[model samples]
Target: MSEKSSDTSGRPESSPESGDGAEAAPGSTPAAVSGAARVSPGRANAAATKPARASTAPVPPQDTGPDVPKVPAYLQTQPRPDVWLGKGPQPPGLLSRLRTPSPPAIGPATLWSVFATALLSALLLGDGLGPNLLIVAVPAALGAFFAARSAGRVLRPWTAVWAVGGMALLAVPALREAGWPVFLAVVSALALGSLALHGSRSWPGVLLGSLGLFPSVAGGVRWGWRGVRDRAGDSRGRVRTVVRSAAVAAVLLIVFGTLFASADAAFADLLGRLTPDVSVGDSPWRLFLFVLGAAGALAAAYSAAAPVRWDGITVRPGKARNRAEWAVPLIVLDLLFAAFIALQLVVLLGGYDKVREETGLLPAEYARQGFWQLLWATVLTLLVIALALRWAPRGGPRDRTLVRSVLGTLCVLTLVVVASALRRMDLYVDAFGLTRLRISVAAVELWLGVVLVLIIAAGVLGARMLPRAIAASAAIGVLAFGLLSPDGLIAEQNVARYDRDKRIDIEYLESLSADAVPALDTLPEPLRSCALEHFRRDLARQDTPWYASSWGEVRARDILERTPVQNHGSDCYGLGQEADERGGDEEEHSYDPY
Candidate 1:
């Protein structure tokens, strides 16, 4: 509370009145002025800075209940205006008032950057499916993070870290085609998490994120209705001259334009070119999808950029927490997992041969046998741990110690299972070569381990949202693997193996998406041509424009151009193309986006 007033000489001055809040009255303080400069009477700009007067009307003090906590002045929420006037965050030029009837919801600079990215995204999508879409996700994700930052919410340090990883994951198209639902789930979790706080799981924020799907639709309809109602009720208001002038101009243009077009063939051609190519009778679903996508994208982008207040949505901590109730299940689960780990250790050390003998399977089959089961077990184990963490009791005598020990033990056992799953997957891939399923499982397993480590941290960190952070980080970390081009990576590794030791499975390689196109550069002869042929056929079918070109798309396009058409027949797929009847399958299975 400070005070300032003008002296007889018309220079502004601050009085030594304390706690009266006579600080240049109120809102008329020079916005750019700071520190002692604002009250400097002798300053040249002092005359321009008109002091605001306090309103004569009194504001009643708000009643906070006795139990309600006093918020710190700095932490106290501010009243946000529905609209902002004045030059905004721009240089006040001569035409500022005329040009800016209302500024964009976000600032112009932010909007321009976002618009550029969105346009790039639209152009890429026009070219059909490829790394172009994945690549576009980067700018979108970055834009979202920037938006969140600008929204001015106080964020946890780790939130930014995991968000970056999540954004990287969304760019990888290969993760989508991964056989398991795990990859998609991970991506979705990370995306939603970028919007949610680990603190409360922000159920209201979650609800709001869902609202982003149709924010423009709902907001526009509501706002439009209000505007119409206001206009109808306002008795003293004149019909807006600008609107009337536009109507008159439109009428004149229609009449004169039609008469001119009717009179001249050249004018008719010019009118035809000038007219917009609008579809009057578009399909309902197509229009619906387009609107939904546009609105959802905009809403999501806005929400990300300028987050709403979420403190109201936070979960209240419970007082009568039963630590033993939480500890029992965790201890029991850890014991069960610990025993299983013991059995796994035995199997790893020579006992695997005995189990194989009983199963009557070959060495490769033996290694494959437990891999999927172990992978599934590891996934389920993490789910259990997450649930336990979510439901864990708070603030009991020795509760932290007991819960931490139990959760840590369970995590350790889970890591062991993750390790076993990876070992088995490695053995299987080595024996039978790579497939989408195997590679995806290995990735899932690796991520499961990462999640477990984060889980261990959650137990140790003892923060409220640590479980959520664990889940978020796990999802983000594994999906981030997609950025490495899992399909292309697998293709390259397998191709190199084939070239080195003649261990190629051309059928499997041919089944991969266009992501593998560039990696086929070193593959020998017929198989390479066959794969290129399929990719080329796919390219010919695509409508990929120049703007959205990706490395995979461009490489595949180049390879087909360079390779002789004669070498690209069924002969490259060899006798297996005949035996498996995969010729038709390749046509169906090629890189066609849904």
Candidate 2:
């Protein structure tokens, strides 16, 4: 990757002979290249024969962005380095043809096929505003399949693992609400995996490739658009014929069908049935919108599956000239961590009572403190460890030992903090009640804990495969979690809590979407009836459209099993005699799930 160097700054550099057939020289500053041999006679004659300049006045230099590239050493030898320097007759002025931008290249056909798959999956997952895990997983799984299929020349095992793993993470929404954070995790992990799989030599390349998923997809779309434009002259193309025919047929059908429908009642009825009732709001807006949405999705899916070349984008740790330089700083850092660890141990032994006493706060308030901050601290510490290793000076065994010992110690200590955080959260939850955010954070902290364990195995124990193991574990964990069902878990936990403590909040349970109904069914007696009554009223009140009945909606609908009128005790769920008495003072009717 480091074989050739034209510029240290991230810019496109130019050489006098860059466009010429002349061999390239080593990349260096103008001063370093002053000693190179002069240009040959043929080049001189060609330059001499070039057309006269369009303007006699001196052309002002243009400044590119701040990270400007230095002119190649060879450029200094030329009287006018930016002038045309090729073998053939040239255009006048200093513009080098090499800087001409080329259009982005579209992905292989297989990639487009994958995008189509994602589009279909998106449609199947949901219709309107709510989040859908199925949508995330559908595209994710397809993206993984295609990523593996098109991963460039350098394929790492972790790449495939991460791609597949990322897809699994996307599946998390199937269990819980598909929050934006989960989507972020899905995209980032998938991008990282794809970049790693492509054997990106530099971290910058990995980052650019990952973040560029959207841009590249958009670029791919541009490329495809241009490609279509370029072939605009192709009158015989199948696409042209299809479009022309479809347009003509649409017009003819509209005109004649309108007339026919006006003239004949039976024929009009048949034609009306043929016309789809689908619309955004009594118009064809949703259809047009779906078309645009499908196009964007198609482009994104294809773009992600196919990445652009980013070989030059690289960033690496700067190794020190001597190992001794890293010694003192590393040792000092280790001591600080050691001290911190000692303090943490003391605190751990201090017992919950001491924390409660010192903090002078209730269990809920106390639990909230230190947990989030400590979690962030552990994350930053990992990043620090990474940075120290990356920018490390050459080190002897002692340095590695110190680094490893410190890292191992930190990992162990962080686990202590993680445990503390979990205990704190549990205490808080017990004192109060569970919420989506609380439960979700608990899962996230546990996942982070798993990540720390993998870091320990990789950093201290030198278990090379553990990083891949970590990725795999994360993906598998989310997938398993999703399959177990997050909404169901939350519902179960809160319901169980209510059972244990008699703190059921019927109104809050009622507010949850039907997704929570199946789990809420496990609730006993009046509470169960109370929760289901809301569903009973709403389900009976509004009709589900055929087109909008996604798998989630379908599942929730299935839980009703039967109409409320089928059974005598089917009195809509209630709150003992309170709700029953409120509802026309009816007797506290018996409630049965049956």
Candidate 3:
């Protein structure tokens, strides 16, 4: 025991009670003090808990005093509430937005919103708000929506209708005046909303946004007008076009105006007979129509030679050759067209002389004979087209500039011819009410002009140069021609020949009957002949040839519809009657039948 105790004493002390009894003695003293205090009720419990911990181990030096304050429960953080905590997993990507299998189909109500918007635009543009508003607005607006939604997609049929209609509306003057930038902004916003709400499937929504320009301006500016001046093409081609156009206009003005103006003098000298004035300028209407016709004819011919596609969004030529070689067919077509034009002049001049010699015709008779003139002219045009396919620029894989030059020359010449024809036809009586024929001629002419320029610019250079320059130039030319031409001046003239003729007939029938022949004789040979031919036709009351009937044969000759008709009774009679009735009440006038 003594040995063991000595060995243990030599080992490390485990506590203060053993040779380390210093720690245990202090702890035990505290416990004894606490036990004594515990004899006094509540304080005894606190002392008991303190004694147990102190007896087990000494306090660490790092510990702070027991007077530390407790933390408040309100300062603690709580767990977050999850919105989707219990929900099933969602689909990734865009599919997540969809709640059902099928997205909502655009219905009538939504479509109506588009239509209403478009119609409102048209009304502001002054495009005669009417029952056919759907026809006018649906295609443009829908097309635009689809174009924007699809970015660059083709649209379904219904979507197509809306896009096209919407585009038409945006083109109106009221919207265009708002500036294209703002217009486009609105379109983008509207398009986005439409896509979000209606979910269009059309690919052409991308294209319809492009249609914004179509409605505002017939030829949307591919590049601004300034672009037209900066870009260059075949330098020779440009200079040649400008020079040729100017020359043709000058020559035509001189030839047609001079020869026709001098027709009465020549008649008196050669046939020993006096005649009336034949000068084009004296009859502003005639001059105007002739120029318009010339312009129209040229435009139409060019259009036929180089057809436009996709409603002017783009131009793709009908021919299947390289553009360099395309000039071959175009040139041949031009030459043939030129020959046909020459033949027409001969026929017009020759036929005119014979009609003048037989002066018992009425205006109807003259018009009837004019049908033959038109027929022959059409045939000549067809023949020219045929010849082009056979001989000129046969496109047999040749590297040539002559074909291009020829085609370009023809294009220029066509403008000249159309202008000349319009001047000759006397389309407008005054500036406001367009004669049916003249209006039709003008419409066809203007549209063709637009198409020709597009064909040349797009088809010719589509694969080579960017179309921006050519498109802009063509657009400017078209706008200038439309707004500044004599046609516009006459468009403002508020008189109608039909109105005048009826007034003259009612007011001075006796005077007209007595002097009609002398007056007819005084007219230049062509006019006299035209008058005589009509007079005879009316007297004979012959049935108009069926083929001679206008495009809408039995349909009412609504000039607004742009239909051609043969022997369609002139609307002038009723119009004249109404005018006579209105004026007769103001001033007493004796009605006499000649």
Candidate 4:
């Protein structure tokens, strides 16, 4: 009871005094508050002896619980508690980092990488890497690597190293055979590396590459739809823009298709007319046509479709702008230009004459002839442009006044034909190998040229549905000219050969012309006799097999006879030196550098 009374009395002594009473007398110091209680043990008993103050002061609040942990001021509101638990680095938030983009940790030496790729491609292209692994594969592999690496910046160095190494490794088998197992292992590694390192912050490259691939896979599926709508005159929204674009595309298709059809027809006729005839070599023009049909359809479809959506995959929209849209058409024009020129050179350079000599046998020729063709096509195209300004029909106002478009397209086609005719004329007078009959043939060739020009003018000027009208006309031209070939009617045939081991088999040859019989007596027995008889028959006109024209001819035969066989008697051979030696992957077969 006494202790309880003292405890209560002590509160009065510890309380702060206000007035000049006995408890508030001089010499008393205010007690210090410690921790949370605000009353120390030292001041409590002294406070008990004094009287309480009369003023109504509120009682102080007590904080009696055990100490609780406190976060530091700097980290008080941080989102991750674990960040505070450990001293290691933490990734920044997604949104915050993107707002302020940063440069690389180490500035890239992009030029050095480009130089390395180029240097390596050149080495592989020079036959520094031999047979078994071909020079053509370099571009394909390099292209794939470039395309894959364009997806992400992070894998640039890794991709560069692998691309270079893979190219170098491809030459290993050529330098010295590593057998099939090793080849398979290397190929597998290439595929895996391609998949793993493919990354990109910018989606523009990927989108374009995919679009480029689509036309090849889908064929004319999309083109057929667009062609229909294009003819319907449904121009709305950007109406003028729509009409102008469709007109340009249609004109190009018409011009190229007609020129190509005419050339094909003329060449077939030239081959047929050659007396003491020879078999013609393989025509890359045919393969090019197939590729064109496919690529054209795709390009047409892409042009018709609205631009692709660019949302999650990119940081910006329209980064590449409409460049691809414009670029594809120009590229198509250039490719067609090249094809047109090549067909011309084939006619002038005695492709028909060679076919007569090698009839019923594959004639060996590469599209290296494309260079000369490209040159002639350019020259003739300029001439045709000048002529079209004087002759093309005026466009109606609803057609967007596309007089330039129509004229330009017509000019390009005319130039290809005119240039082809000139090339044929030059061949007739060449003292190195001319006959009087060849001169007569040249006169016929001139008349045919005039007819072709007339047909082309009619097709362009008369047609309302330009692209399809031109396509149907081209198909008609091919069948018609093909039937009138000078070699007489084409027939199925075969070439008999005695292999190195002295076994004989009838190797199938595609087609033969009836006029080729006179050339058979010139060759050595077996191969000579076989080649002679085949030549006499003109068996080189079939269009089915892709490589048929290149088989068993002088260049191919000589190279094959000299080349060391691999994969146990396979017919694969090395491609000649490449155009640019410095831009491809060397190791993989399907690599593409562009």
> Who wins the TM-score comparison?
2
Summarize candidate 3's per-residue lDDT along 1-594 as a digit string, tens digits: 677456444432233233222223454564453333112223333333343333456523422358767778897677766867755575554222321122122223323333344433332222122123333334434433432343233445533443333333333212111122223333533343232222223223233423322222211122112223333332557657766998999899667756765877764364322222244454555445334322322222121112222222332334444554545556566786677567545334534344345444332344344433443443354355334333444444353355445545665555545543443343222211333244445544554455445445543665232222333333333333322322222222322333343232322211121113323333333333333334334324523222222222112122212322233244323433554455442222223221
In angstroms, give how far residue 372 of model 2 lies from its true place: 2.8
Residue runs of model 3 more than 4 Å from their true location after superposition: 1-336, 339-402, 427-434, 463-594
After superposition, candidate 4 runs with Cα above 4 Å error:
1-39, 43-527, 530-594
Across 407-434, the per-residue lDDT of candidate 4 in tens digits comes to 4454456556655554544532221122
lDDT tens digits, residue span 246-294, model 1: 7999999999999999999999987765453234453454355344433
Please report the TM-score between candidate 3 and the true structure: 0.29
| C-alpha-based local distance difference test score of model 3 | 0.36
Error of 1 at 172 (Å): 3.6
lDDT of 2 by residue, 474-493 (tens): 65665665555555666777
Q: Rate the local accuracy (lDDT) of all candidates.
A: 0.55, 0.55, 0.36, 0.35
TM-score of each: 0.57, 0.59, 0.29, 0.23
Which segments of candidate 1 are over 4 A away from where they belong? 1-124, 129-217, 220-294, 301-332, 349-360, 386-395, 465-468, 471-475, 496-503, 563-594
Number of clashing residue pairs in every model? 3, 4, 94, 44
Candidate 4, which ten residues in sequence have the lowest lDDT sum?
489-498
Q: What's the lDDT for residue 560 in model 4?
A: 29
